[model samples]
Target: MRPQHRVSARIYSVSLRCAASLALALLVSLGCSDEARPKAGAYCKISEEGQASACLAPAQHAYPAFFRGLAQDKLSDEQAREVETDIAQGAQSERSYEALSTLAYGYYRLARAASSQGTADPETLARLEHWNELLSKAYASSEKDPRYREALRQAAVDVGSRTPPLGLRCTDADGKPARCDSTEAVVRAMDEARDQTGVRGEIGRLFDRVFGTRP
Candidate 1:
């Protein structure tokens, strides 16, 4: 072969080898990359300041969009590690509350006794407290949000370790006495409220939730 042609061939061969090595390296890297595996999952789809749900995200370092309880339980080591990473590095002050809530739920699932269906640790209560604080802020920002009120009620129920009591006060919007038709006064109040307020009986319902009613 000519001198220049031989040099050119050598250079071409070296370039081809480098490209092959890089591609192989990438393949190996991907093979080891647990964070990107669909076999595992993570939660990263978020829209609001304090809302979250699962979504099948594009191939990103962020967690998966959503998964069922069985899927969550089947999370791979990489998935768990990514969640741990999010709890550590990703949870800035801005996302701290949401991150904590997510972590708490994960722990709750892991720690709960299958027979009893209760979490092992009480510290989950602290994490839930932080979550509720975020929710309260959101609700305060938008009091008219029926979802926010429902969320508040759910949080209260979850943290209090009991179902929310029936709102117990008995009076009409005009502050007049309303007689109960049944022994269960809460249901009776709800019926009366529906009768008075039409579809938007939330006003009386709010009073019941705030003050609680007896049966």
Candidate 2:
């Protein structure tokens, strides 16, 4: 072969080897990631053929997006990481109530689940406390609205203990007195109350005023 052709061939061979090495590294990294993750078959009840990982995610990450993504069929590692970053960022500001609440409730629910399985640990306990503090900020930002108060109360429920009475006091859209015995019911009642009182419009206005429109 000509010297130039031989040089070209050698360069091509080096490129091929580099590509193979990179691909092998990627496969090994993926295998390690899988091994680090809790096995879906052991930790999850398969709601669908491929939903086991999604179902097991919230237990591992303790984030609302993971649970919501399971229902929406969009769960992913990237989404979980995004939610974690969002929550961390929101923790430093009063304007990110929605994100903070989501994360706080996610941790609350996860802690409940962990408690039930007798797997609650110091790390989880510290995280739950941190989220509680963040939730407190969100609640206070809203002027201690009855709805937010009930949300915190609901999160405080000890799932490992005997079921406690929920005893949520609320009002309907027509300002009718309402009561609930569960956290979900409390949220529903608050939603109905907001719909009735048109509080959501006010909330929207407040958001716009506080956070401004995204340019």
The reply for model 1, stretches above 4 Å from the true place, is: 1-126, 162-215
TM-score, prediction 1: 0.26
Output the TM-score of candidate 2.
Answer: 0.29
Q: What's the alpha carbon RMSD for model 1?
A: 19.8
Per-residue lDDT of model 2, residues 41-147, tens digit only: 22132232222334345454445456675354233555445555544443233223344334433443554454565655544454444444444443444432433
Write model 1 residue lDDT over 10-103, tens digit each, in one string. Answer: 9999999999999999988887764432222233323333223333222221345312331444334445444444344321323323433344
Q: Candidate 2, which ten residues in sequence have the lowest lDDT sum?
A: 37-46
